[model samples]
Target: MEVKVKVWIEDDNRNLVFGSGKNEILKYVELTGSISKAATKAGMNYKKAWSHIQVLENYIEDKLVITKKGRGEDSGSKLTPKAKELIELYNQLDEDIKKYSQKRFEELFLKKDELISLKEDDAS
Candidate 1:
C-alpha cells in the first residue's frame, strides 16, 4: 500500500492561496523567469497561468512576482522575496506532513502481522 497527501493554504476569507498546482506554477515561473514559459512548462494555457498568479496575489494581498517589460529575453518575471519565503515555508510544511503521516501510518497500519501473532498466542 502507499500513502498520499495534499497540502494547501487558505486566507481568512476562505480563499485558497496555495496548493500543489500553484506551487508547480510558482516553481516553474521561478525557474524559467517567464510566466508564458512557466505555463508552457506546466502544460497550461498562458492566460490560465496568469489567472492563477492573480488569484494567489489577491488572496495573499501581496505581490508575489515582479514583471519586467522589454524586448526579447529582457522581458521576464521574478519572484519577490515574500514569494520565495512562502515557497520555502510551503515546502517545509509539505515535508513535515509527509514525514509525520508516514510514521503514523507505519505505526497504525504496518503491524498487522504482529497483531495476528498476538491474537494467535491469546487463542493458544
Candidate 2:
C-alpha cells in the first residue's frame, strides 16, 4: 500500500559514496559542528561516523569535513562547501526520484480507470 525509497550515490567503480546514512551523519555534523556529537545523534559511535566520512571522501576524492584539533569545547568539525553542495543536490534528486516513483507505482497498480479495463487474464 505504500512505497519505501532509498537514494544513494556510487563512484564509477561502484564504491559507496553518499546515501541516507551519510546524509544523516553529515546533517548531524552540520548541525552540531562535531563529528562526535553527530555520531551520537545518528546512533553510532565516533569511529563508525568517522569511517563513513572517510569512505565518502575516498569515493568522492574530496575532503568533506574540516576538523580543528583543540581541547574540549574548542574542538569541532564542519562541512566543506562541496559537502554542502553534495547534500543539497543529493536531497533534491532523491526527492524527485521518490515522487516520480510513487506516481508511477500508483498509475501502474492503483489507477481506477486501468482497473476498469482489466481483462480476465489480468487476474492471473
Candidate 3:
C-alpha cells in the first residue's frame, strides 16, 4: 500500500497544524540557532522562513520560537520555554509511535509471511 503517514495536531478546520514542515523548521531552528540555517535545512529561503515563523507566531498568539543576539559578535535564535516543551513532547510522542508501529508491523507481517487461505465457497 502506498501511504503517507503523519502524526499531528489539527486546527479547528481539521488541518494539520504541526506536520513535517513545521517540525523540520523547528529542528533546524534548534540546531543552527539561526532562521537562515533553519530555512536552508528546510529547503527554503531565509525570508520565506521568517515569514512562515511570523505566521506561526501570529496564529498561536505567542512566540513559539525566538531569535536572540549572539554574544561577542554574532546573533542566534533560541527556543522559548514553551517551544522547548513542545519539542520535548513531540520527541516523546514520536518515539512512542515508532516503537509501537515497529512492534506491530513485525508481529503482523514479519513473523513468517504467512499465506492467505481462500474460503471454500470463494474458490468456485
What are the Cα lDDT values of the candidates?
0.85, 0.88, 0.72
RMSD of each: 4.7, 3.5, 4.7
lDDT of 2 at 25: 92
- List candidate 2 stretches off by more than 4 Å: 71-74, 113-124
If scored against the real structure, what TM-score would every candidate get?
0.82, 0.82, 0.70
- What tens-digit string does per-residue lDDT give for candidate 2 at 1-124? 5567888888788877789889889999999999999999999999999999999888779999999988777578989999999889989999999999988877776766454334687667
The TM-score that candidate 2 achieves is: 0.82
| Best-to-worst ranking by TM-score | 2, 1, 3
- RMSD of candidate 2 to the truth, in angstroms, is 3.5
Candidate 2 weakest ten by summed lDDT: 109-118
- Pairs with steric clashes in candidate 2: none
lDDT of predicted model 1:
0.85
Model 1 Cα lDDT, one tens digit per residue, 92-121: 999999889887776776776443333555
Q: What TM value does model 1 have?
A: 0.82
Top lDDT model? 2
* Model 1 residue pairs with clashes: none
